[model samples]
Target: MKLFLYVLSLVGFLAGCGGGGVDSIADGDPSYVKVRESLREASSRVLDGLRIRGSYQAEDVFHVSGCESDSKEGGGKLWEAAHFWQIDEVNSGEVQSSIDRLRDSLEAQGWTIVDFARPPQVKNTVVRAQDPKAGYVVRVIGVQEKSRVAVRVSAPCFRASGDS
Candidate 1:
């Protein structure tokens, strides 16, 4: 009975490893929610008042910096984290228009446009911005031909304590 109980406890502890239940990607981010809200607001204007398409998000907790996670499920030491959103099913012409509107909107709000790119091989119109305080970075990419767009809002890098 004692051996069985010990094995059960060990299994339970090991089962918790590499799981998202250990810690959330946004656990210590105080401005995470607010930044997301700002992203939606800025994107909605360019998207014709429509909210984030698909509402899809990809978040991961990194145990080590500048390296990939060991597990495919994306759990690590919780050192770094990121979230992304993708929008599709838009008109190509509208994609350009939306990107222009978003660029102007961001500029008007004091966000400095750091980079703009239109690669010949790729159809995506890309825009990158940094806040005045440098607290966050925002990226917007739109493929006019495919009518697809993606936005990524990232928080400042910080050390995680490996605690939930």
Candidate 2:
């Protein structure tokens, strides 16, 4: 009888821990939510003027410094978009022109043009469409210092049938 009671108590304790454990729910971090909202807002602005065949998907990740130390540490993912382009016969100048057009459009909306590269990297997500059937992805990172808001924009390159 004593052994049975001991076993029951152990089981109950384990069950309770599992139900109310720290890992059960997220930390409810406000920073993450803030970053996400900011990304959504920025992405909407960036995509305002563009020829996209479909909708855009923007994902953002935020990192904060000084959380563990004296200095502030932070990182984030802004936005991503998919586009289709012809790869067989596109020239560099044409691609540049397209990018320039997009850049100008974005800038007109008050987005700061940080850097433009042929093949975008962590710092840049813009890609030149080289294949007719192939598509390019674009990503942009920007921040609204006032609200500590950041955004990354990415989209695929879509070329008209006769355009490319």
Candidate 3:
């Protein structure tokens, strides 16, 4: 009986580690599917016109605000969905133009450009945007050394504490 109980407890703990068994849309959960789809759509806009050279990754994550009272008891917590698309290689000369186009598109869609940095001061060109109403942010990092560009879009978090 003791061994049986121990094995059961172990299984339960492992399951919880995988997000309470609500891993992804492929898990057949309708709500998860919707959230994943929405995040993908938002992220795709950021990668528009970019040639994908490497792998793409997307997932749901719990963001910790460092206000967690017990850290385990959940003092501060937010749930988010995000996606990233990485480009194979960036053309050295076209970095500026690419950033310009991305900035224009994001601005046209009502996203506010928070920060944009170019070469000389920084080796990589970076663009960050935020949507106040939607509560999401997007970042585009152009790595000159790696000759790659990565576009990431993160959804507005759902606070666990119910605080706005």
Among all candidates shown, the one with the greatest lDDT: 3
Ten-residue segment with the worst summed lDDT in candidate 2? 79-88
lDDT of 1: 0.50
Residue pairs with colliding backbones in model 1 are 63-77
- Tens-place lDDT digits, model 3, residues 1-164: 22332333234323332233232222233443454456556655665634333423222232212222223445434345455445545666565667778888888888899999888888788899997778678888887777667666666654332222
Q: Which ten-residue region of model 3 has the weakest summed lDDT? A: 59-68
RMSD of 1: 13.1
All predictions: root-mean-square deviation over Cα? 13.1, 21.4, 11.5
What would the per-residue lDDT of candidate 1 be over residues 1-102, giving only the tens digit for each residue? 223323332343233322334343342344333433343444333344222343222221122132232233444342333334456676656666666777
* Order by lDDT, highest first: 3, 1, 2
TM-score of each: 0.54, 0.34, 0.62
Where is model 3 more than 4 Å wrong at Cα? 1-18, 21-29, 49-77, 159-164
User: What C-alpha lDDT values do all the predictions have?
Assistant: 0.50, 0.31, 0.55
How much lDDT does candidate 2 score? 0.31
Runs with alpha carbons beyond 4 Å of true place in candidate 1? 1-78, 119-122, 161-164
